[model samples]
Target: MDQTQSSSKALTLARHVLRVEADAVAALADRLDGAFDEAVALILARRGRVIVSGIGKSGHIGRKIASTLASTGTPAYFVHPAEAIHGDLGMIQRDDALIALSNSGESAELLTIVPIIKRQGAKLIAMTGNAASSLAREADVHLDAGVTQEACPLNLAPTASTTAALALGDALAVALLDARGFSANDFARSHPGGTLGRRLLTHVRDVMRSGDDVPSVTPEASVAEAILEISRGGIGMTVVVSAERRVVGVFTDGDLRRAFAQDIDLRRARLADVMTPRPRTLAPDRLAVEAVEMMEHFKINQLPVVDDAGTLVGALNMHDLFQAKVI
Candidate 1:
């Protein structure tokens, strides 16, 4: 009961728990076999969603697994086991697949519904620590999620078992993702409001300011006239175009400052003399994220957008992309 003795005991318990959980997850690699494939096959073949359910800690893990499957191009959702028996069994359909979690495989609430799910012609996939237990034996496919020992010293808590189940769930998700050739674009579509979705789906045309919003000047345009266009457009830069309206170069505020440093007469100088030649431009078809990358890499804030023939079509600044969430 002394302070030092209490602290020492707690530290020892913590170390033992960490070691046990780590071993639980590490053992999962060797446990991978055809059952994982059978589970994926059941899910990939389903016309309806994957219905995940469990109780307590297993329920928490089931919800996360359902979300991962849903966001990764597999349609899935979670249903509470107790709720399923109370008219929630209607949630199960002939085309859907069910994934149930139970470390003991004998949770009365879960066992109560396995027959009902099978009766409805829905396939049940069980993730359990005991293969011979009721839920596992009844499942169309049973995944072994056994742990060598619980992290609890008395060996009766769900700690290591839950870790094993979560890892196995992730393995199933990733395997299906690869098998289906689910790409980043597919993930982004399911997550359109998320940052990754914005980065992947935004095209230059979606964010680039067009028509009267663009700053443009003729190659014959005077430096003073180009400055007026840039100032009017408020992009801190102007696209210098030829008589045919094709972009030949770009002039910015820095170009004007350099002109001032050299004592060049703004009224007399032409834009070509002060413009940066071979200025970078993006096609409207390019991803807006690429535009952000170009701006960051070249250290420029404003860029001209051009057509396949290199004619000036539009202009954009960093602010435009930021507002569109492409940055």
Candidate 2:
């Protein structure tokens, strides 16, 4: 009856919703049989784009599935079922593939277009709760998205069925992605405006400080010089390079702290004496996320990016990765 009690009840209900939806998704994994394989083959064999259509709540799920397919190299778009009946059916072509969603597999709007779609010679893939329904029998491939029960308290709602359809759609997208050897870079292209795309597609050259901004010292420079470069560059580390400007090693904050712990003399010691030998470096063209992983794996905060011949071209730090959303 109190405010805290009401908040707690809402949280509990939200948790239950998540758990039920997760269970609905897990059930689909177990139900992946020959039908799934046949549907996948149907999509892969099509030389044209996939045209997805559905009505009502199924329409929203269809749109999302279409987006996922597009971003993952499947090339798809959603066509509203009612809209299709009003001349939007021209969006489909003979070489294209059509995926229809109808829980009962007998949506009037969807059924009316099925004959027309077949007459156009486009392959039809049906996802529905009833495998014996008209849409399923007419489809070149039928994927049963049946759920035993609804997660909704009232059985009239489409909760569990929609969750099942969404999960099955994701499975198809990922399977086709793998089959096509879709790379992280490939996914990034479709999502270039987002953080994930920046992380996956951005290269060390894109985020790293280059030319005069890169901090460095020769083998003969004193530890004091290394500290000055580290401070001036504000990256907490400096690359040690040979006379040809090839990166030979690096000195970092951790190295300085540990050296002081060992009673090493910064006032008189050369950078070569305290520098880490062959410190890990990234290529200028390496993905920024790859740099994040390497840094995290080695527990380092900064890296020197080099060219093919090992000459230091740029410098990058955890801050750079954070700014680029690679973290």
Candidate whose TM-score is highest: 1
TM-score of each: 0.91, 0.83
- Cα lDDT tens digits, model 2, 158-265, are 998999998889999999999999998798888999887888778888899998898899979999889999998999998999999999999999889989999997
lDDT of 1 by residue, 1-327 (tens): 999999999999999999999999888778878988889898888888899999999999999999999888788899999998899989889999999999999999999998988888899999999999999999999999999899988898789999899998998889989988999999999999999999999999998888988888877789878888988999899888888878889899998899899998878887778888889999999999999999999999988999999988888999999899887
Error of 1 at 167 (Å): 1.3
Candidate 1 versus the native: TM-score? 0.91
**Residue 99 in model 1: lDDT:** 96
How well does candidate 2 match the true structure in TM-score terms? 0.83
Q: Which pairs of residues have clashing backbones in candidate 2?
A: none
